[model samples]
Target: MGEHPRRRADAQRNRDRLVAAASAVIAEAGPEASLEEVARRAGVGSATLHRHFSSRAELLEAVLHDRVRTLCALADELLTAPGAGTALVTWLRAVVAHAATTRGLGPALTGYASDPRFSPHTMIREAARQLLARAHREGSVAPNATVDDVLRLANGISLAVDSLADATECADALITLVTDGLLRRPANG
Candidate 1:
């Protein structure tokens, strides 16, 4: 027989808490953060955490999947925004922010790049592609700009400023510089 609905809901809630706690702990304590700490943060026991995610890799994958889903959703919402160029810039900034927070998990995520079920790389690429296409169509961005270019630039900026005393400000400044360069110039200018 199937599991009881309330029990299933409770299980799902526990899973959500674990993922959230893991994300927070990892963001603050790096990828090496303890699973026990994650359980503590979630207000659940270690056993519950294990029941939901058998291993660290599985937990990290879940966190990455959740984050990527969020980014993709943001891209979709921004696609219909009033200004294509602005939307692209906004989306890129968000991507950079997420990258900064998840930097510690970079190595772990790389291993899952080949695993179709857990990989967020493709979704991220497609989101960038859609945003870039819209900006190009609107004539707000350089004709030659590619998704790879934007992603590389954002990732670079994120990594470069991650350790600065004013990292947020620095990132914004760098993004502005890049966005200005990306803008389409008038033929007569």
Candidate 2:
């Protein structure tokens, strides 16, 4: 069933405002940030926020969806970068940078159990699979390390360093740590 034209337009506008507001609030204060503040910032009433999101969990999920779409696009960009190791590291850096930008996103995305048909987790796994496969083929990553392992490691780094003052530094350290752990040592000359 289709809605009246005006009603559909209003709904679309509301969705845009809600998404913008949620992104702002979530970036500022994490997923647990105030819903009312989001509504207020969006220049809409709390009732309207609830009308659009229905609940805090729903808003959080939507914000995550928005972020994942951007992140996956970045992963696509990394696919064309030179060197599998460089591309993998570049992707990891980008992922961590994104995680730092969106407070609580790492945890929210990791915990949300959306259906695979619409699940960002599944998309994320596919992205990881591509990069990890390439890194393995290039002999820069461990042969036994699965996409799931890389994701878990990345998620753990994001969660652990989420609140640090120097999250970028922490993320770099974690990435280097993981990379060193995963790479094989060169034979002595």
Clash count per candidate: 0, 0
Best by lDDT: 1
lDDT of 2 by residue, 1-189 (tens): 788999989878877888888888887787788888888888889888888876676787777787788778877887777788778877878777778768866566565565456777687788878887888888977788888888877878988898898887899898988776776889999
lDDT of each: 0.87, 0.79
User: Which residue segments of model 2 deviate by more than 4 Å?
Assistant: 1-10, 101-116, 139-145, 176-189
State every prediction's TM-score relative to the real structure. 0.88, 0.71
The worst-scoring run of ten residues by lDDT in candidate 2 lies at 106-115
Q: Which portions of model 1 show Cα errors greater than 4 Å? A: 109-115, 165-169, 181-189
RMSD for each model, in Å, please? 3.2, 4.3
Candidate 1, residue 29: Cα displacement in angstroms equals 1.0
